[model samples]
Target: MSKLDSSMRCHAPVPLAASHDRNARRTLWVVILTAVMMVGEIVAGYITGSMALLADGFHMATHAGALGVTAAAYAYAKHHAESGRYSFGTGKVGDLAGFTSALILGLVAIGIGVESVVRLVHPEKVDFGDATFVAVLGLIVNIVSAILLSGDHNHGPGGDHGHAHADHDHDHAQAHGHAHHGHHHAHGHDNNMRSAYIHVLADALTSVLAIGALLAGRYLGWVWLDPAMGVVGALVIAHWSHGLLRDTAGILLDRSDAQLAGRLSAAIEGAGDVTITDLHVWPIGAGCHAAIVTVASTPILSAEVIRTRAVGIKGIRHLTIECAGPA
Candidate 1:
């Protein structure tokens, strides 16, 4: 859509509260189920004497733990929907949790990779039967959990809180004669789903690899393959985590580090009767952003207009425009 059309005033915030109760409850249940499965897999790994299975189990444990964080964040956001402390209370919590989880995953990946390599060097006896059974079971669990979070996977991360209309100085025509078009976020569950999906997908993949290696080693006596596969799995996880962490951390710190800052500055200057004396743009949370512009002019750009222009600039969620000239 044209920037002008999309930049129109946000009619209201997304509606997230109604689904809060059900969504939170669902997240909580997933957390519990994951925890249970983690334990089960670990025990099975020991019985089967499969290092790969044990590693996969531990990975599942990490995912379960991550889900716990997701659940907690969701609950906090839901309970504090009306809190004045947050202009948008706890909405970004999921982003924070997802970012943190991704970082953790990377670390886990590195550790697993290193251990797997070591084992490969010193080939060990692994019972293929035990490991294979457990790996299959773990895969099943991952699939089920993935299905549970299907809704989240499809929607953008944000909550369905009511909408708000900021005051504006200009007399602009609405899209449909006073009607505006904008997207509403249901809740931040997408992050939760993303995190969950990552875990399950990785687990399923590593588990399959582990089963293959175990079979090959048992049948062909290629013991080194077991550890080799482990290292591969670890490296994959590490790489994935690195990207996730970097993105999340960027948002958390509200980094203004971008090549587009200059362009955005000029755009703000052109948007209204103002000389863009200064501008600061930074991310507030994942997919949400904020910018501050300093200007001097009669009937200078109102906060709403600034917001409109800023939104037109990608990644801007909230905006504050300061009029420094004569009123």
Candidate 2:
């Protein structure tokens, strides 16, 4: 067992993400925009006696806070990458931020649902004129915020922080002691940016719905439609929150994607007399994975030889090989 241990441990460079700085800057700008609009709406709502404006202003406050979480996560991950605090670095910070954002979104949905149900039972005299004006303003702000947060995808065909670019992949044998063979393409969505974008999208959706409900209440005398729309919007928002929650939770829990594992295995075991005794693979960052494999071979192949054949699975940024020979 001691002879099998090569005393060589290698890890991939931790991610700051391909678009981390750009996305962080954009999210910060959105936080500023949301905070400013939130204050403006709250002040105007009190002056104009518009409950719709007041509620939307508070909603924007939550979004600002959520986006702040995203920005902080990026900063922390970048700054602490070499701090050695996390076993796999702080790349997972974004997943935690996304998970927190989803929980906040769920709370917002629950609040809206409860308020809508209450309003439906005991209808209040809404200031339709003022509400319509605020709703329009909210829509404009949301559209701008959405434009700022949208399309922050990292199009780089490598793992986060430059894991397997074509030029870089050629040096894995010298660098990591294990040469990855055929695959150098690894990409994952920037989930932190995605969470922030979803917040803006959710706001835009609710604003549009509010405008429709306000118009119906103001002109068509269908005041009930206002609360009805709130209920519907809450349900839709909850669904979005649930999806984000599920994805982030899976990443945080280190749940391996089975499809990814199968692809990785096919590449490693496709040739040679290698049979894996144990394999563990899990995501360490957005589009990057860390794998530990224990293998048995009749001729007792070197770990390096096995890795030379295992290189084709795209997202495996880090690998640890333990060779079990005949004793």
Candidate 3:
């Protein structure tokens, strides 16, 4: 039996703690700012006896809560990155947070939809002066929050440093008769951050709608437009929430990327005459994937040769290749 008889494990390097910490601190700041604004809105709403102000205030509160979740998740993931309990580290913690936040967003949308429907059925007198001011304030806050959260910062589950080096090592080892394969997958931005950003944007959208509704009602006497705008904002929020849910849920469920799988199969088959008996590919972190390939190939086609050929494929950071009997 060749040295390749044993199963090979190639796991990608975990994301850096510094990146997670940076994002966590950013989210923490947002949470604090949002909470303070939420309290102010709620208090002012109560004093003014404006349902619009009160509703916007409560909406701000939900965003604060969701941002809190994002902050906590980043902190936890950073703290536990090296823990042995998590087989693949704690990279998925952010995804879990994103999933939960998305659920909250969906609930908020539903609540807005319901309230808007009720208001549409029976219009009420809106305190345009007070509500418009508060709505404008909320919009400014949301815009500021969005700016704070938005940027080209790469705070995702995978880091770029050392990825090329790692892949090179596999290439060097293959030359020395060692079988190894490593591919770095490029993952999208942090979903948790995206969720947080979307929350602020959604709030901002509501604020805009509120302002428009109030203005029209105050000057143009189109009171019904207020609730109608609410419905539109709710639909937008719900759409965003649904997408977030789908993405995070797919990650949590270990759903395979079909394109990635196809690339892997092609790489392996292109190497030599081999029949893939079984293959499993799953996401282990934000943009990192681990794969297991079982193949039946000619006895002369060593596992090292197969692995060497597949190493060029991107986004497969970790791989295990099992070679069985000859075809």
> Each model's RMSD to truth, in Å?
7.8, 4.4, 4.6
Of candidate 3, the 10-residue stretch with the lowest lDDT total is: 164-173
> In model 1, where do residues sit more than 4 Å from their true spots?
1-26, 42-59, 152-190, 257-267, 271-273, 298-317
lDDT tens per residue, model 1, 1-327: 112223434323323433455556776777888888888778876896777568667877777887788788777766765576665445566668878778778777877787787776766667777777777787787677666765534322222212222212222222211223354443322454456556666676677788788788879988888788888888777766765666556656667835546756766667556676766766433344445566666654344555565455544444455555443
Question: Model 2 off-target regions past 4 Å?
Answer: 1-12, 153-186
lDDT of 3 by residue, 18-112 (tens): 34555677788889889999888888778977776787778788888999999999888878877767866776888899999999999999999
| Model 1 local distance difference test score | 0.61
Overlapping backbone residue pairs in candidate 2 total: 3
* Clash tally, candidates in order: 15, 3, 1
State the TM-score for model 3. 0.86
Per-residue lDDT of 115 in model 2: 93
In Å, residue 46's CA in model 2 sits off its true spot by 3.1
